[model samples]
Target: MTARETPESIVVVLGTRPEIIKFAPVIRECLARDVPFTLVHTGQHYSRELDRVFFEQLDLPAPDVHLDVGSDSHGRQTAAMLEGIEDVLVDVEPDVVLVQGDTNSTLAGALAAAKLNVDVGHVEAGLRSFDREMPEETNRVVVDHVAEYLFTPTEETRLYLEREGVAGQVVVTGNTVVDAVYQYADVAAEKSTVLDDLELSPGEFCLLTAHRAENVDHPDRFRSLLAGVAQFADLTGHEVVYPIHPRAQSRLDEFGVDVPDEIRVIDPLDFLDFLRLESTAALAFTDSGGVQEECCILGTPCVTLRYTTERPETVYVGANCLAGLDPADVVAAGSLMLGKQPDWTIPFGDGRAAERILDALTEVETDTDTAAATVTPTETTATETLQ
Candidate 1:
């Protein structure tokens, strides 16, 4: 293999807290390698409380451009972001624009970049739930087709792209969330006092995070999930700890859903605090895709509340199970995962995913024109080459 020049400049676009979390490693990689990059936050899922503290906690540089296109209907939200992102791409004219996961922000960023002739490098690319009811599923498909560089997390995902015949160069770079988890697990443990504060012990609590529209937007579904989770905790004899998103909490209140006394509801936690809980918890029930990846990586058994998941690798490895909204099934799935040994093979890659991704961009590809090489993390400046 030979070395090609690193792209002259890169633009990163993200919106939600998960995006912020998952993209931190890539942003840090840019910093480490002295890559000239710019950060553009669409603010699609912005909250002052979350945005300020999250960046501080991750120790990431602030967004160079904040397109403060906050919450709205899906059409309005994505359209505004698409418009704003196009403007930014026009101004910056970056060589490539980086987007992560399946969100409106991801779709907007990819579309904007593709329209402007800027190459799009999509992280966590080629995921599919096969259920088009999900806005995320649509976003994933569109972004994958539009992207020039598709960085997948697994061989399975790479194969999916192959089957779809996407024109993008696909590389199985592993999930960036795994990289984030490995990077922050020890740091969270050392710095967070969540267990002490919650009066919880290792393997004694069951965490719950239900914020997805499919689960929480409908009153009956929301109520059913709450009851089902309560029953699951009761069956397991584990305390149910719910760190509710403020938006979901309001929806619950609006729906007039009764909370079971067994489930303890609390305000949201920062990344470190939540990581502390998730790492120690006996089990977790969530509608969050990111939580599924994180719990699986942390060796904490998880039951996904959603009907379908883009990260099915977690389920394939026995680290997670899908228990979509039946009280009986929810309890059964939780019970099944509770006593199992955490012997599941880690499917994500070595912790050096960021290094390999950078290497692929800067180093020449193998004869297959697919770059899935791993590299050791060494001091490398912008002009450094992979040899």
Candidate 2:
């Protein structure tokens, strides 16, 4: 009934590669501290490159449970995840369910845990694009309201929660992505040969990724984006390398959208390989929230392909610009961003978020246990005196 009631166990649920990357530090901290926790994979991103390869590359333990809920319509995917996650919650009966980021898995994990009367901990919580048209915004809002612990990534986000009157206990733990980037940047540089393999020189090739449902599901927008990439390449004379998402590839075939010769289309890369490419890129053009944050930390200028973004810090700091879905606009934004200096400060954490999160969870449990122990004798004494 109170924040002091400690959870006996924790279940960490994730579905996509970004979630895996962001949560990897938390998972590692749990293992290192000998915390009682289990990893559950909802299989939101099912491809080997997108999913399993990250575990191998990151040296993370394989998930104890995999829901295998692959791609589908938003409603159907959420429903499948809810059903599968509900089953796991019932069996495990964890005192707390931990979910990161705004995804279907985050929403489902929170909803199921709340329904089961289990405590919910939402990492990277209180993010808002203020556009209900985007499913991620809706997921974030819902999860924040239900979570017992809101581990927000920034002070701005904590204020967002306060303004919303969120009942959850909010803590500004900073974004764990910062931790992931600091931990892996050097590893990627030492281990990855992506630049050599792709025959790319540092800061000479533009890296691109666009696979948001809003962009790929609409034919005109998708075509316009492709045309814009072509125009950008033509204007800058820099090769545009796109590691296509499976969804985008399907849409390309379905809509008969042609990729330009200057744009090299390739399969997705593992986390290390992609980080190596991203860190060395001339500029990144993407519709991914994760990429926007990655570029900001890596000091690379970025052109966001979406109309709006939840991560406004990157834009405010002048490390990123929103280019929407127009070809001419995308080219212009890319050209403008290329000339800007990468002299922005990192707005995220100090790369110690995981340790802080583990400390917070441990403190909560200890306080809860101490409170329970103190209350039992008081109630017992009162009862004995009355008798």
Candidate 3:
């Protein structure tokens, strides 16, 4: 092990709603440990609903650096974020940067840090949809290859890292989503009046959240998914409550795809409100990977609108099923899931992922002091050549 150099200083980078929810635990852990960390917001999700609401709802501290780099083409967005993040890394000079999931923001953070010869700790690493077409898959693959420490949610994902021969210390730190759910479920239950506000009763509604680029970018596919969801809602006798994502809503408007009357479209909810609904809903239908994990943990059966999912544990455990965008298939999958009980063993983790992630980070010796587990600082990550 290399001798410890300096006290750990971390830059936590985030841009979207899920990143905020998922990263809250690690931030809270940093507070508890008195680890000096800076929060950097790339502003990838520009809307207040999609970004700021999460920080406020989660009671997370505001970002120390705000890049304000909004949406664009994937190439443009990623390049902008990379440049902005590089500036922050230069200014902060953090020992490591922490990025979560497979968003462009995640990739940018890892890339910026690796370019500067900084260690990167990736949360929820090694997630693979195995579909090259999905931008997320590319982001995940790239970030995993560059990151020094890969904190995966499950042993299955750890094996994925090993199989890929990724040059990183892969640790199976149960997902921080589980930690967030366990920590906030009770709080959400007590504080959230979302059901009452929406005039919804438990088991009376199905939650729908479809914001994947492939699903919403095309008018035909988006409309078909909604039609299928509408059918699923009718079949299950549960009204679909869709807290529409901005991207999906924009496509609906631009493409002039009329949403079915059976599906009630509403504004996006804060994490607490959404979590409350997710916990109480009879069923959930969505294309979101994070929602699948959340519903699985909250005991809500989910019907995935997409064909492929990185988090196949939900399907393996009977908590979720892929219904695709076909109207009939969506209805069938929803019906099948509705018949089953939400008793699948929590496949993500034991609700201590934040602690575990930090523990692994702490184990990473900085400058030549022997730690049982130490992440060797990469002068140039293997992914750099690919970049």
CA lDDT of every candidate: 0.84, 0.85, 0.85
lDDT tens digits, residue span 1-387, model 2: 233433468999999999999999999888888888889999998794568889988889999999999999888998999999999989988988999999998988899899999889998888888978888999999999999888877767778999999998877777889889878888999999999999999989999999988899899999888889889999889999999998999999999888889899999899999999988898999999999988888878999998999998789878899999889899999999995666676666666678767766765432323322222121221112211
Q: TM-score for all predictions?
A: 0.93, 0.92, 0.92
- Sorted by lDDT (best first), the order is 3, 2, 1
Ten contiguous residues with the weakest lDDT in model 3: 377-386
Query: Candidate 1 clashing pairs?
Result: none
Model 3 score (lDDT): 0.85
TM-score of 3: 0.92
Residue-level lDDT tens digits of model 3 in 254-362? 9999999899999988889999999888889999999999988888888999999999988987889998888999989988887466656667776777887777777
Candidate 3 off by > 4 Å:
1-6, 363-387
Candidate 3 — which pairs collide? 2-367, 2-368, 2-369, 3-367, 3-368, 3-369, 4-367, 4-369, 5-367
Error of 2 at 170 (Å): 0.8
